[model samples]
Target: MFISETQIEVRYAETDAMQVVYHGQYVVWFEIGRTRLIKDLGFHYADMEKAGFVSPVTDIQLSYKRPFRYGEMATIRTWIQSHSGIRTTYAYEIVNETGDVCVIGSSVHTVVNKETFRPVKFKKEFPEWHAVYEKEKQGQ
Candidate 1:
């Protein structure tokens, strides 16, 4: 359906002693992908926060296939896997320059009231964003 593509250049610091990307770095890359995808859909995380809510990662799963070396370019593909009133799930793929899939993952998030830290229905808080997510999620 609707997919967002973002490019990232691996940095030396992101690698380990073997010059391969450390296992933890993939999580950061996933965030980058999520941020781009939301922006591409015409919404801003900061604005969401300013509106008195925050979307926190409630769950995350990552799987590594091949190794990604430092200094290599990567294409991160991200999409909304599912979106409901209470939660949104996003899927991700990180591929190296050679078109090899380096990792696949997904993250689950839910919006919470900023001050109370209580879960809230996204559809009720942001109808426009919910509409966009509903349309894009249909493609998945």
Candidate 2:
């Protein structure tokens, strides 16, 4: 699998009263990782939006294994878990500087017309993007 890794410095704003990174922050990190993966694959999400299509999250799952503190460095690893004509699933793994896995997750998304909000087949609307996703998907 072609996994893209993005490093993030835990900020105080991302922490909670418990002094650990806020759980909700991981969701933002997931978006960062996914965006990096798409850039690494030579695609710009803005281009997709400019083309009048938007990929919206349809499902999401996350498992938190450990807590990280502010000022710590974390790496978010992301890859295409699966892809179909209509939907794509992206998997993620987050680890601390010491290389301990802190979180694992997946997000599913489907392309839709920006104005109509109607579902669109990725293979038909963005064949090049769909082809790269199919080629890099982790499993059948």
Which regions of candidate 1 are displaced past 4 Å?
A: none
Clashes of each: 0, 0
How accurate locally is residue 121 in candidate 2, as Cα lDDT from 0 to 100?
A: 89
- Local error of candidate 2 at residue 133 (angstroms): 0.7
59: Cα error in model 2, Å:
0.6
Over the full model, what C-alpha lDDT does candidate 1 score relative to the true structure? Answer: 0.94
Worst 10 residues of 2 by lDDT: 131-140
Off by over 4 Å in 2: 138-140
Model 1, residue 136: distance off in Å is 0.8
Encode model 2's per-residue lDDT on 3-98: one tens digit a residue. Answer: 899999999999999999999999999999999999999999999999999999999999999999999999999999889889899999999999
For residues 13-56, write the lDDT of model 1, one tens digit per residue.
99999999999999999999999999999999999999999999
Q: What TM-score would you give candidate 2 relative to the actual structure?
A: 0.97
What are the clashing pairs of model 2? Answer: none
Please list all clashing residue pairs in model 1, or write none if there are none.
Answer: none
